[model samples]
Target: GGAGGGGGRNRGGPGGGPPKASGKKRHRLASLPPSALLARVERRGGGGSFPVHCVAGGKLLELNQRLALEPRLLYDRPCREGYVAILFPSPDAARQLRSRLLSESEYLRVRGLSAEDLL
Candidate 1:
């Protein structure tokens, strides 16, 4: 199985906004492989549902309960406090993940986004 770990992002949301809380379990204790379903983020007004997946194979450590309680955080500060879950990958998986991650500039270039666009 592929290495699984890391935080997730909600790429599919209304106006490309952050994901809404699914109100599911706050803690997941099962081992998951890469691309496994971690959580589901649904839009408030029946917009659409997005599934948050595991990046690498690992154990789910914790889910951000705050998102479930205060969904505004997802819009106010999506990158900081709106993260969905924490996963601890195996040692080998961690090393593999580090090798696969793109540099900040490379990621920006690939996404066709400039630093100013983020702000």
Candidate 2:
């Protein structure tokens, strides 16, 4: 059983073009702890990289290898075709993670953005 989430995305509109592939990092996921680093997303055109961390502790079910080849999917269709990894968390871990996640309004408020800003 795999769960979705923990994907990287760009902040600008979809006109920046695709990012070039550079040095890649690999992780061994024999066991995943809560807040474990899953992947690092490097900013296009030379900036700092962002770390993608796991939300819960469990096993890694699958990785979307397609992103390695087509990183643009993350900017184009993040929720559809650009997922980073799939994980199967334990019942307790899943519950805890869900409880801590912010709702849509909560997230927008925390970022000092309104719902219309996302549109």
Candidate 3:
């Protein structure tokens, strides 16, 4: 309805500056296969350029391949700064792979990266 769970934030906190945008909302990634290898992508310039995370099979993170793809994702391999690759799993689980990288990816701390593997 209202851009998922990203709504209803108390903007009048602290100094009472304009309310900082609340975190993102988590949604189910639809249509996937079982145990398939996939990737989650949080493209740059989406907003604050915040961090995004995804996991599969004990953190299916092949830094070299993915790091290059998202120059903005923040992965120097072996370790990431803040928000960069903020997770080992997609902050959730799936039959195969999971990613909070799309418009559906949950917001900051929104929780549960469940994917729909109807295959």
Candidate 4:
């Protein structure tokens, strides 16, 4: 299993940035149903669009709905901008799924082991 670590520059602070939305909207994204389409990652330079389908239950759906409104942001900061949608599933499943995932050290240790030995 592949897991993305959450670590980056904080986009919001006293320095000033985009206007923050209400807490109600944030809560909705943090709790999405199963089988929901999270976001479509579009290629830069008009290459193509790739849909980001969600398999897990819990997710932090942070999609920039205003990508169409301000397409320039997509070009300027593709990493920090331009998401089609977002979705989050059940919390219990998310916990179980994460718990089953092997850490970097564990993966390296077991990577070369035979299937029978792994068990």
Among these predictions, the greatest TM-score belongs to 2
Model 1 alpha-carbon drift over 4 Å, by segment? 1-29, 108-119
True-vs-predicted CA distance for residue 62, candidate 1, Å: 0.8
Q: What overall lDDT goes with each candidate model? A: 0.62, 0.60, 0.29, 0.46
Candidate 3 lDDT over 1-119, as tens digits, reads 22221212111223522122222332322222233323223333342222222234333222233343434323221223212222233334543343334344443234333334111
Assess the local accuracy of residue 97 in candidate 2 as a C-alpha lDDT between 0 and 100.
Answer: 85
* Residue lDDT tens for model 2, 1-119: 01123333332113432222222242544467887666666556455557667789877766566766676676555556776677779999989989999998898787666666565
Q: Model 3: runs farther than 4 Å from truth? A: 1-47, 55-57, 65-119
Worst 10-residue lDDT window for candidate 1 reads: 1-10
Q: Give TM per candidate.
A: 0.59, 0.60, 0.19, 0.36
Candidate 2: stretches off by over 4 Å: 1-29, 103-119
Better of 2 and 3 by TM-score: 2
Q: What ranking emerges by lDDT with the best candidate at the front?
A: 1, 2, 4, 3
**Per-residue alpha-carbon lDDT of model 1 for 1-119, expressed as tens digits?**
11112222243345544333333365635576888765566555555556668789877776677766676555555456866677789998899999999987897697666766455
Looking at candidate 4, what is the lDDT of residue 84? 37
